[model samples]
Target: MSLREIKPGNHGYLYVNSHPTGCRAVVDRMWQQAPEPAGDRPGPVALVIGSSAGYGLAATLVGLRAHRMRGLGIAFESAPTERRTAGAGWYRTARTAELAAEAGSDFTFINGDAFSDSVKEEALDRLAAGFGKVDVLVYSIAAPRRKDPLTGEIHRSAIRPLGTDYRAKTLVFKEGVPQIGELHLPVADEAEREATVQVLGGADWQLWIDALESRGLLADGFRTVALSYVGSDITSPIYRAGTIGAAKQDLEDTARAINTRLKGTGDAYTVVAGAAVTQASTAIPSIALYISMLHRIAGDAWQGTSDQAVALWDQLVGNAELELDDEGRIRLDGWEMDADLQAAVRTAWDRIDTDTLAASADTEWFREQVGQIYGWDVPGVDYEAAVETTVPWPGSPSTDA
Candidate 1:
């Protein structure tokens, strides 16, 4: 089916199946824009912690296609047992492994929890036996909750505003309406907040590094990166500047600590990626509305999660040293959160007096970009052709099932 026939709910599946082709295009564009990888040393081995979807998988594909790196992905989600299946991150890794096979590069997928000691040990063992050491380690896990393996206590994360009553205007994507609402920040007692900090913050990141280093699985002159985002002040109380914001602050600090640990070898950095609409981003209370409006105002042809991932890969993975401000965090999201940009968007939003918010907010470029992310607006591809095909999961346990 053409991308148009696939409704909003199933769009993510379609994107994953088509991502290999999309990633190829991204790689071609990156090579055209930037210089090639520095050395001919056997293509670097990379391990992507959250390699199922979003930026994690994008970084994996970018390393493969643009930098010619061999990769292994570790995802907590279940793998697909059937062809043309739509499990999260399934199609991405499948497609990536398929292409890697075609190019004679190694690719592996491990379905397990990234925080567990056993899983980390397995990953390290595999890397040591196969590739000796990994040159790149990308931590991109974004789970809503995590169960403490030892205590059996489940910790859930909240995206609501914390400690302050904040009023905000947001968009309803389904109804295509703009409405104002007050965000009731959660009143988490001290323990809950501390738990939130422990679960969502950077402790797991540090743990992963410790596990790898203890096992001596890091390559010399290795690079490691983690992804973070700081959204607009409008959503700050709920996002970066709020409870999750506190988590991110811890994450940034962890990045610095990790960088210190990796100092003699090479570099460890955190990428404060720009905000685009992702499954994780959309679920936040006021963010969907913000993204919808931000999409309209920025007018730089806003793309979906896949496109954002591709752009991130091009800028951060394919090229080293992001455009960082004096604060040391990369500033891709800065433009989106720019004071003037947010102010103008807010002004335009206030003027949206009627329910024709979709029409009022719609821009030709934004629509076109969203279309492209779903494989709609791209040129030279026959939309009518039967492009639907099974996702080939390389090295799956049994093809029969």
Candidate 2:
């Protein structure tokens, strides 16, 4: 089979195989922009949970290559080979290791379930010998469901509003047409909110930190952050004020707890990033529609996942004072929630429909961005070249992929 013949999988779920050319392009972009370490300043060692794609993967790159930090990544990803499709995250993790090896940087990737106590223990085990004194921990998990290791209780998060139902125009972009329809989500009750928090909240984040500190694994000035999103009034009802919002509120409270516990030694905070058409975000009905409309209005300003991650790395590592909001959360969604930009987006949101969607919505751009997530839209790669699928997993040496 030819590489160019590899297309996106069903409903934007997986890529049949890893495209070597496309995968290389993804990591190369990070290396090209990677910064050098300063003299007299050794890079900080970092531990990145959910370090497979999106901000998690980008943060790994920034820490290991851009900031010259030693990095230990924890993620759950699959491997690609001649007979089967591997998720986009597989390529993201593999390519990052390949790049790290080329530069002779210390980058260790452990492909295990990160939300488990055993996994946390494994990380602690490797901290002293593999990489010492983790100075930063970046939590970027985006699982839809999680099973607690202690209780064995499975928790699922639903994307719906609280108090009252919500109705909005949802969108799905296709090859040439945009499918726009009204999506209504019934209000979630107390039980659903609790489940969402159990799965998506910062409990696990706090748990990992406590485990690390208990073992004396964290170095001085240690800091941890979990990414979040609280968008405009347009998306507030279904997003910022919904089941997901309840979970985020719990995350904020957890960050406060962590901060209070670490008072003089370290700090934990939640950073709200910009709205992007992420693989995870695409799963949310109303969010996808809003982002399509947003891209249409902010054509030049439609920030993608990498944009948010890269900017975040620069700000965090640039040696400047961290700029935070009233609640003490880092605000990285400035332009995304800009009053004037959102006013324009609100106008577009009110008029968006299937008929107007093709012309008025940035479906084409949205489609391309989605494809890029799975390493499909890269240019100059001979997708038709006779393929080789021998890429190895990050920690294993069999090269089954």
Candidate 3:
């Protein structure tokens, strides 16, 4: 092993390497902060579909450490290579397995393409052999593309408006300085629009549920949630009212369809989550700028992905009751979308520019949060010293994936 100073490979959405130490530290903090279990009976067995990073990983921690549930996490991640470490999610899953082991909670992780029918079958087989039945399933997959299992066609998702061009203030870095810059996202074409829906929409989610249900893997009163986002006015033109929005609407529709198919044996919901710094969120236009402002306005009170995941579990499984909006979807973004908060964010958004970006938003904090996603800005990690570049993904049978 040699000392490696990993940095952002691009505008900051992608990184060259991930630090195992920092990743473990971040997971440890989330596990420590998660609320204790609310029920005296044994917790539910859960299968978190995207449980490696972001909300999926947080939900895994919530289930294993908070609710004391047995969990099986499925994610697609790059394993450690000769010249580079594994992706941040890989390290996170390995560490999560360790934490689960310490707590005597059963946790299994599979790293593979979740959209593949073979992978779904593998997950189902694992569920049958180990978990027996799943009471909870969290669909939190975010990908730029997907390969259709039935047709063998690859569908790629795009971040673009529907009919009209979208111009917005997006976060950009000039010579390593965070700046508010204008982004002009053109409307996606017909084929691109359909492709976006194919990749990001509810089709894959429905497939997973159907596979599990067909195998008699879903326990009675089974509950599943697909994480989603609906942006504010400043971002709606490029986000909520864009191609992504259409896909999210499909996701909600799929939830209703699943409910109908289950015939009260289970429930499905599309959970609208608050904006957080995730790999997918960073790539979206205007999200970085908006999230920076959210961080600024809610300093010390800002709820990160882990906090949001905990709150979600509390409502979904803890003592709290499940609250739904008019559309029957869980609206966990309510706190982030408070009238006063959005007003403050809009005021900052209006004034933000390269000159006033730092003052209008917590640019440094935003950058740090992004760095922490790949285990860079985490506190007390000795980045200067040589660290292992090939951290083993504990007990993962699909490490080669």
Best by lDDT: 3
| True lDDT of residue 297, candidate 1 | 74
Runs of candidate 2 with Cα error greater than 4 angstroms are: 1-5, 12-20, 34-40, 173-176
Q: What lDDT tens digits, residue by residue, belong to model 2 across residues 1-401?
A: 31325544545432345565676677677666656555545677889999887778777887776577776888887766556656667777888888887767777888778888888888888887888788888999888888888899989988889999998887754554568877788999898989988888988998998898898988888988998999888889988899888889989999999988888798888999888866778777677677877877877876766666666666666565676999999887887888888998898888767778777777767777676777777766676665545566777766532
Please say which candidate is ahead in lDDT: 1 or 2.
2
Pairs that collide in candidate 1 are: 52-89, 161-185, 171-289, 240-245
Per-candidate TM-scores read 0.78, 0.92, 0.95
lDDT of each: 0.63, 0.78, 0.85
Please write out the lDDT profile of model 3 over residues 173-200, one tens digit for every residue: 8778887788887888988889988988
Between prediction 1 and prediction 3, the one with superior lDDT is 3
Q: Using TM-score as the measure, name the better of candidate 1 and candidate 2.
A: 2
lDDT of 1 by residue, 307-364 (tens): 5544555554545446666756655565566777878877876676335565556433
TM-score of 1: 0.78
Cα deviation at 10, candidate 3, in Å, is 5.7
| Runs with alpha carbons beyond 4 Å of true place in candidate 3 | 1-14, 38-40, 396-401
By the TM-score metric, which is better: model 2 or model 3? 3
